[model samples]
Target: MGGVYVLGGDWLPDAGNRKVLTELPPQLAEARVCGLMQTRRREWDGAVVRDVLSERDARLVLTIPLSTQERRDSLYWMAEKRGRFTVRSCYRELVGEYEGDGWMGWTKRLLANAEALRNRWVECSRICPLCDEEEETSVHVFFTCRVAQRCWAKVRVEFAGDVRQSIQTAFQYMFSVMDADRLGFALIVCWSLWQCRNGAVWRGEAVTED
Candidate 1:
């Protein structure tokens, strides 16, 4: 038997695609299908890069298919079987409000406006707008930005512990950062910093965290 790939199902539209289409109209579904096709072809990076889902990807990620509880559990197991990222943390922040049995999240809202961000990245002809640091990309948006580093420093000072500098390490630090309220506040601040980075890139607006 060949490898079981998510995009390798019969060309005939399946319930999955139909569900996805309902959430994201034809144009996005086509783009998603293209991205998934690249994945089927063993192009992991291409698949992820090709994904233009942005905010929609965040929104669609949470929508569970209607089925028996057991099947739903299995589906979740497969969907979440990959390595976790900061994006998931952002998603969790939006889960209670936007996640109504669907994958809607703050990141998804940001992604919905990805084209603007992409345009700013290319045409706006600016360095990292947040701090005028380096070029804006996943690396700069999440880490390596001076403004972001400052926020992290605040967390480090408050925690009064050896705060790891790596983005992954900061996530672990979030676990022990005090009460639930403060932890959530920290997470939202991180998310806001990322969103502000995009706002600067896309809208050419420069504002600092006060």
Candidate 2:
């Protein structure tokens, strides 16, 4: 106990080995000790520090020195490299007003372009064939189109009874209650609506709720 050197300031001891008060609390005392080793220009492997603490706890602190932005970028890079880019990229492609011939492509466009959606309404010849006019877009066809509203009325006559029809804010209206498969189904529903619209336009076919 005679050689014990207590510290009060943040600075580490110099090569001459004078005691510095670190003023660190118990939880931080261990970290300050480590900082001292690092500051003295001492050569200590990171593994040596890990070996001194529990594995989980040490790993948590190992990456602590990184700045906030650095940590975010590292996490994003890891996720992108792991193939999680579909949701955002798909959303952007939709916003760009892209159109496609199949389920994947059409759905992407429908979600993005209001005009393309109206065209489906027109094609169904069940009503109007325009992605514009608010009547043909995804929100309308699913929840508010006169035809669609009627369909839902059958299921819930009181549905939106006195409420005005409203557009969905895509970002705010995510189906969090659904499981992964159901979530996928929601995406598929968007795709199918686009396909139905296209069939109405090119085929001059009549559309049905089914």
Best by lDDT: 1
**Which lDDT tens digits does candidate 1 get at residues 68-147?**
22221121212233423344454354322344533324234443223446755734543666776566554355555777
Per-prediction TM-score to the true structure, in the order listed:
0.35, 0.31
lDDT of 2 by residue, 124-185 (tens): 32344433345345566555555544444444422223232433343224333444444444
How well does model 2 score by local distance difference test?
0.41
- Deviation from native of the Cα of residue 107 in model 2, angstroms: 14
Q: Which residue segments of model 1 deviate by more than 4 Å?
A: 1-127, 135-144, 149-162
| C-alpha lDDT (0 to 100) for residue 183 of candidate 2 | 40
Q: Where's the lowest-lDDT run of ten residues in candidate 1? A: 70-79
lDDT of 1: 0.45
